[model samples]
Target: MKVLLYAEAKRLLSRSGIGIALKHQMEALKRVNVDFTLAIDDDYDLAHINTVGPGARFVANSCRSKNIPIIWHVHTTAEDIRNSFLLSNIYSKYAKFALRKIYSKADFLVFPTRYTMNIVRKYGVKVEGEVVSNGVDTQFFKKNEEKARQFRRKYGLTGPIVLCVALPFKRKGIHDFVDVAKRLSQCHFVWIGSKGLASLLPRDVREILRNPPSNVLFPGFMPQEELVGAYSAADVFFFPSYEENEGIVVLEALSCECPVLVRDIPVYEDWLQDGVNCLKGKTNTDFEKAIEKLISDKNFANELGKMARKVALERDLTIIGEKLKRIYEEVLEKHGKKDE
Candidate 1:
């Protein structure tokens, strides 16, 4: 069956998590040989929309008029949108109201995590949906010793490196990341993200980025190839972000067999196992202790990394593609368009 996949604000969110997720999902659909197109053609059997905007609202209305089953992919909520960028907090309530109306119009919904599904429900979204992870590309993110060494040498990261891939926002725990870096002077801390939106960051956060500690390094954004190498070279993937629908970088690090230390959030409950697949930290001191434990105990760290890799393999692109294919077929069947 043919499917029409669309995302709003493609240029604006090119470097954001939602953009990355759309790319991965499209690639997965193509790999599975599913008939899909980016355009809004009249001959499509199903429509999947990934953002909320005027264009998206028009598409949703058109689908409703044509009796086409619409699948709404929920990537952001009001809570996660707050503190994300300039005026995001001020507009969050309106965004939430719009989301509630948009999601209620969908025949079916897709949530990247159970945490997000529950959040939407609490916000009075009555639409039904299932949790499906935005899986990672294990082959692209695999460990490579040569590339890892090259990245380390280029960045002068000789000691244990703690890597955090996040946008420059207070909600992403940028301040917390810097605080932890201050405490651990011996280890090298690298945060890979853009500073172009520094105006959106808090005044203190901007100051911290401008004059960070000697051990803290802000290499800015890197290409995918370089990012794969960075993941391979790092000893720990420390993500202190306060919110996420699902942290795709955590899966990327896991695919590279890197140990992870993330904030203790409910979203990770389904995948992350404390002291097994990865460690969870609640506070700055907790993060410090977790990082220290991983650094001092190489064997335990390796064990956790191995487990994390297994989890990543289960959520690889190939498997997720099959899942999407099944979901599309089921939707078609339910709508009495299976023969189409």
Candidate 2:
């Protein structure tokens, strides 16, 4: 069946997690040979929408009017939106209301993680939902020493590299990253993502980006090729996000077999085991200690990286694509039965 895969603000979200997830979705669909198109105006049997903007709402409504099944990919929730940008917290309550109303309208809901599904359900969203991870392209993100060296040389990054891939926001733990960087001055801290909406960012976040610690570097957004090299070059992939539907960068890091240290949060509960596949921390002090341990003990870090790659294998794009294909067919069959 032809599926309409739609994401609003395509260019704007190109560097965001939602955008990256959408890219993965496209790649997944391609692998499964699913007939899909991004053009919202294209005719299709089913629609999978990945944004909460007015355009997304219009598409959902149009699909409903046509009796076509709509799969709302819940990439953002009110809970995760707070502390994101300026006035984001003030807008979160309204976002919850909008999300509830729109989610209720969908024939199905798609959550990237069970944690996110539970949160949306708590928002009074009762629609049938499934947990489909925002999978990574393992082939592209695997470790490459030559590429790693090229990236390190290009950025003039020397010594042990601590990398974090995320937008500069408070909720993303940018402040905490800076604090940890200060504590671990021996390692080079590189944050590889964009600051696109700088005007909307909180003043304090802007100040931190303006005057970061000597050890920390903000090289802005990198192309996917460069991202693979960054992950390869990194001695540690440290993600301290306070919240996420599913941090695609974490999966990317795992696919590269990069040793990862993340915040002890609900989204990573079942998948990420502390001191097993990856390390988890709560505060800056916890992060500091974890990084020190990973950097000092090469053998332990290598073991963790191996386990982390295994985790990535389970959520590869091919697997996610096949799951999406099944979910689409199941929904279509049910819709057909209703029509019959």
Pick the lDDT winner.
2
Cα-based RMSD of the predictions, in order? 1.4, 1.5
Tens-place lDDT digits, model 2, residues 231-253: 99999999999998889999999
The C-alpha stretches of model 2 lying farther than 4 A from their native spots are 337-340
- Give the clashing pairs for model 2: none
lDDT of 2: 0.92
**Clash totals for all models, in order?**
0, 0
10 residues in a row with least lDDT, candidate 2: 331-340
Number of residue pairs clashing in candidate 2, backbone atoms closer than 3 angstroms, sequence gap of 3 or more or interchain: 0
TM-score of each: 0.96, 0.98
Q: Per-residue CA lDDT of candidate 1, range 1-340, in tens?
A: 8888888788777788888888888988988988888787657889988988888889999999999999999997988988777788898878888889888988888999899999999879887688888999999989888889999999988899999988878888988998999999999999998787888777888898899999999988788899988988888999998889999989999999999999999989987899889999999999999999999999998899899999899989988888888888888888888735
